[model samples]
Target: MASKDLAMGMTFLTQTVTGILANVVLLFHYFSLCFTGYRLRPTDLIAEHLTIANTVIMLSKGVSQTVQAFGVKYFSQITRCTVLLYVYRVARGVSVSTTCLLSVFQTVKISPMSSRWKQLKAKLPKHIGLSVFLCWSLNMLVNCIFPFYSINKYSSKNTTKIKYFRYCSSGFPDKITEALYAAFVLFPEVSCSGIMIWSSSSMIFILHRHKQQVQHIRRTNVSHKSSPESRATQSVLVLVCSFVCFYTLSSCFYASVVNFSIPSWWLLNTSALISTCFPAVSPFVLMSCNSTASRLWFKFSGFVRRR
Candidate 1:
């Protein structure tokens, strides 16, 4: 429950406007994936996962952002509060799961034959879908408990303010629930992030070794071919760096949000913005690195212009 008019105005201006633009970008990307039809590249796990993540982000943010945008008007109502919490919580889960899947897939793609993670390469697609469904369902449960545990009644002394959850709003959850929520946050993150860093480092090492070999050949031979592979490797390096930085920042923001003592509205807004903006921003990053995506995006742009 928010008491300040300034807060409402801030949320509307800072969160609402940015969120609307981010969601518009996300929807465009998601629809573009479907329109270009995963038909051309049905076998590419990276392509499929990226498209699915974008779609999920768009759906979750689309509902939550709209609800929040209109929430000030419906602040006093029970249904609106429940809807807001449900959408917000579900969106949070979907965001985390999609990111975890992305990191894991990238890691597996770059890993060696003897890599312990090779088994995942075969089962990952089915596993990712199942994981998404289960995560969404389970996270929705945590959010649903809010309706039963939370209260949206007006403040005793004022007409403007509202209070949520008489008992459940404050601190630590119950033993079982706390454990479950903690597991949800920790398990995938530690595992996914560890593998991502390892695999990324491995790729960078491989690229460097190849570069060294090329340099050796250049030193001995009078004529050396200036190749595009170096450029491709540089692009991949840039792509990896972008993903790592954005995802790390988003995770940090989310961690701060879990602490009940945090009072910064900007932190909350940034966290939400990062979650929604990733899907929209990621395609641009990928397209910048890959000629195929760049061409497809241009083709899609031309089609949209015709309409």
Candidate 2:
């Protein structure tokens, strides 16, 4: 037990530090580009927002998980729990919604000239700020119920059971209210998932058609470097796939908690661990997909090694 606790604490600490470093590096890359007089692309703007959201996720969720892993018991305090829960939920929701937007935006950006969505290219850039603003506002409003639904007291304290994750739950009301609250939370999430799926599908279709066109033009099976569009498509696919894998795993565990299904302490720990994986992994994904960030990271690493 002691060894396991120590391992978990180390894991949480490593994840927290690594995630923060990745985001900081990515942000610095963008700032460097701006300082050197390069105009920020729409994708760069979205990447900046996404990095900020990831940083928040790492800080809030990472601290909570680290504290829990060490059995700190600080979350047992109602005020602490409320603040942590609010920050985690708000940050997480924004991250999810932002990813959906990024996927969709990239899809539209790469759409063929004759495609229906290609018309959005001109107007989309103008709405980027509005869209990001609305995403943050909507998610903030969605998470407003955090205080109402989170308490430092365990569900075991109440006769009327409520589903809850590792932390204390405010013990929801009767069936009707619980159903309503669940709907409120799940609605935007479901919508975001739908948008991501649609955008991913569109991206795949466009890539396939482009590939066919190129093959037809060449009439040969010759190996060639990937086009910029193809590279962008591949990157989006990776980001979407990673998000789906971690999101699905964590969502299943979260559902178990909400349904009051887990009986073991280990299961709760597993859920917490799964929930934090995406945030911990996401910044690295962004850095890998972004060429400027990748180059900057390599340069920085070389300079450090030489020192």
Which candidate comes out best when scored by lDDT? 2
Superposed model 2: Cα runs more than 4 Å off? 74-76, 154-159, 162-166, 217-223, 261-263, 299-307
Off by over 4 Å in 1: 1-43, 66-176, 217-240, 296-307
Candidate 2 residue pairs in backbone clash: none
Model 2: per-residue Cα lDDT over 1-307, one tens digit each: 4988889888888878778777778888888888999988777777778778888888888877887788787755665567777888888888888888889889988888887876698789888888888878988887888776665454455435654455564566577777798888877777888888888998899888888878865566475778776786678777877787888888888777666633466677777778778777776777776787888778876886799
Write down the RMSD of candidate 2 (Cα, Å). Answer: 2.8
Instruction: Report lDDT (CA) for all predictions.
Output: 0.53, 0.77
Model 1, 1-307: lDDT tens per residue? 4565356445545544444344344345545666876542222334344445455555555435444544444343454445555565565555555555555455455455576767876666566556656756775665565454334343234222222232113223355665575676556555656665665676677557666757867799886764554454454455556556767788788677765444365666566666555555555654554565566667765776699
What's the residue-level lDDT of 222 in candidate 1? 85
| lDDT of residue 66 for candidate 1 | 41
